[model samples]
Target: MEIQKTPLKDCFILKPDVFRDDRGLFYETYNQKVFEKITGLKIDFVQDNQSVSSKGVLRGLHFQNGEMVQAKLVRVVKGKVLDIVVDIRKDSETFGRSFSIILDDVEHLQLFVPKGFAHGFITLSEQSIFSYKCDNYYDKASECGIIYNDATLALDWHLPKEEFIISAKDLELPSFEEAIS
Candidate 1:
């Protein structure tokens, strides 16, 4: 696996060496030794989660605060999505910065979002199946979110607002400023 650093510190794009044949294809999605060597970070994933969303559906800008914060390794297993990660580390140089990539089944690319970042995505195909590994388990009390359309961040979803659909919880999320404060 190769780790490509993103604009935000500690964030990475991981490309695994895929072996293909007429039968199908195989790739080691997560090897502890290889992952630690490539990213120089040791993470003990305690939980795994999956979600499926239809085109135009957006889920995100979410994170867990305090000690519940988690580092995530995410990838799409079907279709495509515009995956995003925003740095929210208070003392980091790249704090408030964001990075995005198109994750699809074809590329099989995975994104590493460090603990102090908020993550989200917008489906770009008819349906998308996404999965992720987290170093920490879900903690409802610590969960928090920033509005996907927070003006200061001005994230370009690459889709018209009217065309997009969001959950009621996502629609009620606070702005970035409110999240930070």
Candidate 2:
């Protein structure tokens, strides 16, 4: 697999080596030993979550706080999305910095989103099947988020604001500044 580092301290874009033949294609999505050898991080993903969203569906800029914080290996299973992550680690040099990438079935790319970051995605195809492996189990009381359209962050969703179909909860999330405050 090819591991590409993002500007964010511990974020990465991983591309697995694909083997194709006349009948099908195969790749190792995750191998604990190889993953640890290459990334130098030992991750034990306890939960595997998948979601199906229609075009324009914007999920979040969300994270879990304290001991509930999660590190995720996210990818697209059937379509495409604009995946975004922000470093929210207060003491880190890259805190408040954001990164974006296109995750789609075609390229089979995956993003490694570490803890201390807010992550979100917008469906870019007619529908998208997004999946992720999380290192920690979720805790509702520890759930936190920043509004996707926070002016301070000024992230480009690659679509018009009117086209985004966000949940009322996400729409009401606090701004970046408010979230860190």
Expressed as tens digits, the lDDT of each residue in 1-181 for candidate 2 is: 8888899998989999989999888988877787788889999999999999999999999999999999999999999999999999999899999999999998999999998999999999999999999999989999999999899999999988888999988989999999998
The TM-score obtained by model 2 is: 0.98
Query: Which candidate number has the best lDDT?
Result: 2
Off by over 4 Å in 1: none
Give every collision pair in model 1: none
RMSD of each: 0.8, 0.8
Cα-lDDT of candidate 2: 0.94
After aligning candidate 2 to the native by TM-score, how far in Å is the CA of 146 from where it should be?
0.4
lDDT (0 to 1) per candidate:
0.93, 0.94
Candidate 2: give the clashing pairs.
none
Cand. 1 TM to true fold = 0.98
Candidate 2 ranges with C-alpha deviation above 4 Å: none
lDDT of 1: 0.93
